[model samples]
Target chain A: MKTKFKKTLYSLSFFLLSICLFTVPTFASGLNWNGHFQTETRVNLDNSALTWQETNLTLQPEVVTNNTRFYGELCYRRSGLLSQNNSLLASTNSNPIELNEIYLDLYAYPWRRMDLRIGKQLIPWGTGYLLNPTSNLNPEDLRDVFDFGRYLGSNALKATTYLGEVTITGVFIPVFTPAALPHQQFQALFAPEMPSLPFTVNEQKIESILPAENLQESAAWGVKLEKHLLGCDFSVSYVDGRYSLPVPKITLTPVGEKVDLLCELIHPRRKIIGFDLAGAYGGLGFWSELAYFFPEEVKVTSDLTAIIGQHMEIVTLKDTPYAKYLIGMDYSADHLYFNGQYLHGFPQEQGKDKLGDYFLGRLEFTLNDGKIKIPFNACLEVRDFNKFQESFAYLFSPEVCFYPEMNTEITLSLRLIDGKSGTNLGKMKDWDEIGLKIKYSF
Target chain B: MMRKTCCILLLIICLTFPLCPVLKSQELTAKEILEKVNSLLNAPQDQKLTLKLVLIDKNGQEETRELIMMQKGKDLRMGKFLSPASQRGIGFLSLPNDVFYVYMPAFKKTQRIATRQKSGKFAGTDFSYQDLGTQQYDEKWSSRLVRAENEQYVLELQAAKGNDTGYSQLILWVSTENFYPLKIEFYDQHNKLCKVLTNHKIQKIAGYLVAQEMEMVDVIKNHKTKMFLEEVEFDTGLSDESFTERYLSR
Candidate 1:
């Protein structure tokens, strides 16, 4: 089955590439092509045993006719561990080539006020820079937490209409795709859980059941209305879809002096209502986004007779509703630019904490007509302030970029992390490292 | 005695009447001359043109770019890069009230340019966003004619209060025949000459007098950018719809 899927993907890629090269020039005068090639190498500061290298090449081509427009991108990436001595990280995929996006846009469709877009495309729907809680039309790509590049596009149909200063947009997605997760190798080495008891457990296994694409009821849809008024841009939207994160339905049983645990990953249905606003006053630019999510519940059962009880207890794991919001501001003066954001996540149910509230800031200074630049960035979690008396996790990244030519740049950076273990960013403290990258665009 | 007094008064009047024309010409103020210059420069309500820019470094290295631009009325303008393979599909749209937007082909995204970013260089050229569109002298600056000599008028313009600009003052040399600007010098906030722009060639096209070639030199950096108008058409029937965001990606 995997081989057949791979063959189909390869054939589709070739077909799209051929159309981009051959059909564009003959049909349109606005045909254009541009892309970039980059390479990066990273080394761990604490241990030389953990090192990685990656190389990427991308191609983007676009064409416009009188009323129809076509856009597409293709990427080839190769990454691997620098040292083979680490057996836990040796199972990762080292090479992959994929089609990032391909879409067709029809302008003034049926009228001059509406537009239609179909095929694989990204639908960005929020004002937050790093994390967009209101964006639910497409699945997120969480392979790298630090990088904010383009997310993987999904097959969708979108229609937009403009009425004076207001716009309305609608989207329909027929397929169900889950958000990509971090590499299993990295997770195994860094995400170890502490045991509460001193007993040895055996036969622990996890099984995930994703919603099949053939299920007609698994489709998602969303709508948004945007307007500019009182010198501010505002938007209100709602989405009914599946949650991007999986919920575990756990089962436990005790037999023959040993315990067996089973975890079945399931994606539950969810509904989100969101709002966003952005505006500028004087020298400061401000933006805010808020979203509220309602998720379905799951069932969990545990056998307690082996330790403290004589019966099996059945517990209900209810997915609680939560609200997430981010507020940010940006300012620039002379050659310095700065941006800061405050994020908060409040759950409707008490005693349940998802990702905690945090603050993020970025500062950049440019010199020599923007040929040389230095940037500093940091993020700090503000949860558990009174009890812990300190931040849960703190990350700092400082980088320098030099542009020798118009289309080329070289960058060097260092990533540092400090926190207590078992936390979101705290667990990755050992991954602190320095990196160098060079990219050329054409 | 009455006949002798009358003859002397008549002789005095005759001598003063011969100098009246010169005094009347000197009565022209700086603002009047600027108004005439503005009228001549903005004669067309709509226009379409192809522009070629050649940038030269201090060491004499040269790079060239070509673009097509269209303007409707005084506030709506759009430009698209046509040459230099890497930047060919980039587009810029300027609207009223200092609103601007840029379309990048590689990302298939059209993003609004912040008001504070107006002072940055445009497309790797020495020109800023404020320099590309139509110039409104009365809106931002006050002018005074310093002198008129050799059939040319030299004027000095100072920035109005509360106007955010990189330059504090500008000096212009305009031709008296057609009221066209021949040379201009820009002074930074520190009162230093930072850049100089000179018109090297002029031609009449579609019943409008136009500058065919011009050069902008950075005095401090010792670099220069030369612009040439390859083609121009006045009264091109352009409308507000042509400058909307819907057409930027196209």
Candidate 2:
């Protein structure tokens, strides 16, 4: 089985290379190669253990012709330096070789003011900072929880048309891709939860079921109209697609007062209408994003509820509308840069009543001609402001970076958190960590 | 004798007609001289070039990066980084009325930059955003002829009233043969010499004068930035579309 898996990997790599070669007309002059190498180690303060350690390299190759641009990104990672678990599954989890993105851009093809882009690529929308409420086209990449706002590129066909100063963009994604859960260590924290039962004495197991790749069930599409008006950049967009995050579909089996529950997570359909505006005023930059979500109803039923005939079905999610929004501003001068933002909801979080509030701020100081820098970043999450003492959590990270050599950066950082046990971040109270990162680019 | 005087006067009048433009230039006020220099600076309808930038630290260690720059009209400009793997695909668009947007490759989005941010260094280089922008010098600075030395005209420039600039004053030396600036010394708010800019290897390309090499030195920080024009083209007929967000992302 291992040999077969390796063979499949090699074949896929060969196929990518074939496509790259065939698309470039002049290999010697058009092909461009670049990327970076990085190694990072983070230690948990609670247990004094290596929470995360990995070294990775990315190779980016792009070909630019007169009318087209083809680009690709591939990464090789080696992780778990101290762990003894070396199973094939664990190796696959580390994902030694991964293709992150590959796309082609056709400029003014088939029309004078239209551009077409096809293949797997990143579609960035919205004007918010790290917390974007309107830019959900690409699924979340939760593999690295510390890296907020990371997303996986999706296979899509996008067409952009220019009409005067207004731009109209349409996109179609034929296949379905689900959001990636966090690493094994944080899986339990990010997993879907089972609904509260009348009798709590029970057994539980989580299972994930993916939707089939069919047009009616798995496909997604979107359109956006953008223009510059009132001294600001504005856009209105609509996307009809399945939720990247899954909803619970539980099956209950009761034995006397206790119940055994099979918690199954499945993707559901949803539609979003969004608008964003960004502009500058009096030397300050400000932006806002607002989005409303309408999710499909999801009802869960048990296999055997003969004893409780009337209580056999439970609604996991109601067909209701919810809102998400973010506002941000930034200012920079001389040696200091500062940014602040407020977000009403986070990705993977659904429903209007369940949303939390987040406040974020970042300040950086550059000294010695950008050779040495200091940055302080913090986030405050409040589940309920009425019970701020017990329902609020805050995380602060202060870091220093030094560029002692050319094309190199070394950073040392500390993550500190404190909160009650009821909120999301409060549950990870013992996860305070100190990290070191070294990166070199060529 | 009357006939001879008439002939001499006619000969002198004929000579004076051709030198009228030259005499006017010689006696030109500082503002007129600045306008003439600015007209030459903004002569190209559009420009395309590859810029090689080298940053040097106090220890003499150097790092290099490359970018492709395009400019249409006077204030519309765009630049895309082509090297330094960490910064590749990063681009910026500058519009006519101090509007600027920067495309961050990691985030895959274009962000608007605040006007005050222009005072910071660009890409860790010694050149600030104000230095990179194409500005109408006569409108922003009051230029006065200081002296003349070695076929060069020295001028002193002071920031105009109500103009918020990083530098307080600049001393510029221009070649008399051509209106190109040969050297510039920048003074800080306290009237201290903080930086110096030098242009070298002046050449005529596509019937336009260009400085093939330029360097800016920050004395206070002991840093330097050297720029080389590896490839240059003039009058490319670049359209307004090139300065849009679509082109910047590509």
TM agreement with the true structure for every prediction:
0.85, 0.90
Interface RMSD of 2: 1.6
lDDT of 1 by residue, A1-442 (tens): 5346446655765686677668777978877777788888778889755566667788878887878888877778765556656333532333477677787889999689889987778888886665666777787665554564346687788998888888899999876776655566454422223224333456777887677655365688999998877777789999988865556566667755666767676677878899998766655677899888777766554755776565544333346777788898887765688999887852211113544777889999977655689999998865676746455888999999997776778999999988876456676788898988999887
lDDT of 2 by residue, A146-170 (tens): 7788787787899999988899999
Where does candidate 1 clash, by residue pair? none
Tell how far residue A157 is off in model 1, in angstroms: 1.6
Q: Model 1 segments beyond 4 Å from truth?
A: A1-21, A29-31, A85-95, A188-202, A253-259, A299-318, A345-352, B1-28, B81-90, B104-109, B231-233
What overall lDDT goes with each candidate model? 0.74, 0.82
Model 2: docking quality category: medium
What lDDT score is found at residue B203 in candidate 1?
76
